[model samples]
Target: MSDPQHSNGWRRFWHRGTWWKALLLVVGYWLVYQLIGLGTSALFHDVIDVADPLSSPASIFFGVALPILLSGLLLIVLAASLGWARGLFRRESLPGRRWMWLAVLLVLIPIVLRLIGTRWSAYAVATVLAILALGLCVGFAEELLTRGFVVNILRSGGYGERAVLVLSASYFAIMHAGNALQGQPLSTVLGTVVYTFGFGALMYLSLRVTGRLVWAILLHAATDPTTILATGGIDAHNAATAGTSGLIGVAGIFSFVYVAFALVAIFLVTNRTKVAPVAPATSD
Candidate 1:
């Protein structure tokens, strides 16, 4: 293989992180993720049912979690190849917006509520374990791509904080557009796109408020299983959903907060720039 550090190579182009380059990176990653998903599904076809990945805990483990794990490993390679592994995990070079905590709070409240309402025993022991793994992988894969890599690129390119938030979140939303190819209904795909846009913004803020990528990773990881176990659905479909009676019924109300904050945060988010600068790893 050719060296990644070659200035004229595609790897160098991605490290420079211009808007168009970021867009191309998104496309490349989407294609790779899809290809990986197809290969994984084929390899595990005897065990996994793509029609309803959430059909059972085992199907989820084999179908959903396993593919995500592979994809995340690929992402780790990309981060290392781009020489971004260190800087991507470090504190934000730009100062964080304190008010963004409200957005994160909005995201977290529902998860906490749903956890209260979730019927723990409804899932098999192995299934819960699998979901946790899936959530962590999803968090790592998604956040590293959008927040870690893309945000670092934009920052290195000297884009303003607001532009970073908008672009990163938009990229995150587009990441979900692949679902349509999987036979998900158009409505479901569109709805998820919108919801993910909002979720993405908050996660960006999570990175901001916490001053590190790890917080966003944890938050994103926590969200998947909470949603899966709470609603008993992966994506827009729920098969074995259990009845919920308390605060969980109202949890859906908090779901709207994501889109709401996404709409407002652009105007509200700004870099305070009060922190001392930390040197980046190779312009990331």
Candidate 2:
């Protein structure tokens, strides 16, 4: 019979390696995102740089939209190029009916939030629509990279389901560290990371239960920009916060509330149904 200690040691070995692997993935992707930013800056050099973050429509549009779009496509391309391409980008990989429900949830959640004690000005309405579209645009890329590619990479390398879920979630959080550049407090940034990690877990569970990336992606995309739109268009911090709000200010309150709602949704969906775990591979 196999020694129990030996089996435990082997499991620990993979677990430790998986954490390190996740660290590397986070670091590597940060570099890739930075490069994309630099490239986009060079490519879109002609856009006027408004003096104020809140006033600059171009900056707001670019900030909210570009990262969402690039992160998704970059991961898909990187996955395909690196030989880990698993048809994640294809429509067939998504759960149809479940995803449709999720899409409705995604769209409705924001609309409902906007209607609740929310003031609607002409510019705010326009901003809401623009922000919603921006969220959807980038949602695909973020989910592809964080939930889709990262999980698959970990699984193929002999990690367990729990390990893959945690690692990928952590990776998602770290990648958003750049939010600090926008004047986000360390606490808010850290909270955002943790909250997003939970989101990542929910996405992973959804994918396993449904065997489709669509619902998870749609759910992931909706909560964020929707909350932002409901509150108001991107704030100074969002447009690149210039160090105004402290640890628990207006933006912080808004962010905390948003994250809380996301957690509630996760609790609801997960408790309502059991997610099937992806089977461990015979060979990797």
Candidate 3:
């Protein structure tokens, strides 16, 4: 017979649908982000404009700094408030191996790109680092809410991993479209989707191997900001049109190479290492 406490908890979990709960979390996060964006714009009105979040110093501060510090703290607090069973903002259930090399590859990709052709202008350096920081925060927030919280909840309720991954990754990729309106073209958006989804798969793999969220978070922070560095500046006016290939015309082909590399690497790593899946409860 099941324990009374376990039965009650299961009842509570069912009473709360994972999708609705996740949707609410996403909405809450968006609202908070909007408020932060507005507040930052107002605070730095003289030095920055909210219209172009990328170009605005205030927006940069908000995106890179505020989200990390403020959102992190709030997530922690909120998690604690929700009680231990929910694991708060923490992904107390990771399921994969540590694959630190994957993260190394992500960071190295941008550095190598710089070595090959991209020159490091002072502005690009600052913007790139800022973008990296921004990506980390972006990853932290979205991953926690989407993959960390929502996926786990659904999985606990008997959802299939394949479905959960597809849904989560699709949502993640589409969210990048906000950048599209700011001069990011369809191709760039497509590239972003491919790369970001690939990252999600990596994170999913990480979860499967180690059963923890820490590695995924670090990988995300490392990978994303580096992508910004590869792009250099945030000058939409200088970007190529849909039909015309831009300065980094090799982007598409290069992406294919990276994807190929990623697949080969994954096969090599898993084949060489017999990493066992960590069960959910003990993963985090």
Go through the candidates in order and give the clash count of each. 0, 4, 15
User: Of the candidates shown, which would achieve the greatest lDDT relative to the real structure?
Assistant: 1
How many clashes (backbone atoms < 3 Å, residues ≥3 apart in a chain or on different chains) does model 2 have? 4
- Which portions of model 2 miss their true places by more than 4 Å? 1-19, 42-57, 83-86, 89-111, 114-118, 122-126, 233-284
Off by over 4 Å in 3: 1-17, 49-59, 63-69, 84-94, 97-118, 124-129, 178-195, 234-284
| Candidate 1: pairs in clash | none
lDDT of 3 by residue, 161-277 (tens): 565555555555555555565566888777777766655655655555545566567766665544444454332323321212333444435455545544554554432222221
Compared with the true structure, what per-residue lDDT tens digits does model 1 show for residues 129-228? 8788889989988888888877777765667778888989998889899889878899989988988999998998888888899999999999988888
Tens-digit lDDT track of model 2 for 1-284: 44332444433332333456656766776777777766766665566243532244565566446755776577666554443445554333323234324424433444454444244442444556666677686567777766666665565456655566567776887777778886778887877777666556556656655566776677656755655544444432332322223321433444344445445544343221122222222222
Best model per TM-score: 1
Worst 10 residues of 1 by lDDT: 272-281
TM-score of each: 0.89, 0.64, 0.64
Query: Please, what is the whole-model Cα lDDT of each candidate in the order they appear?
Result: 0.77, 0.54, 0.52
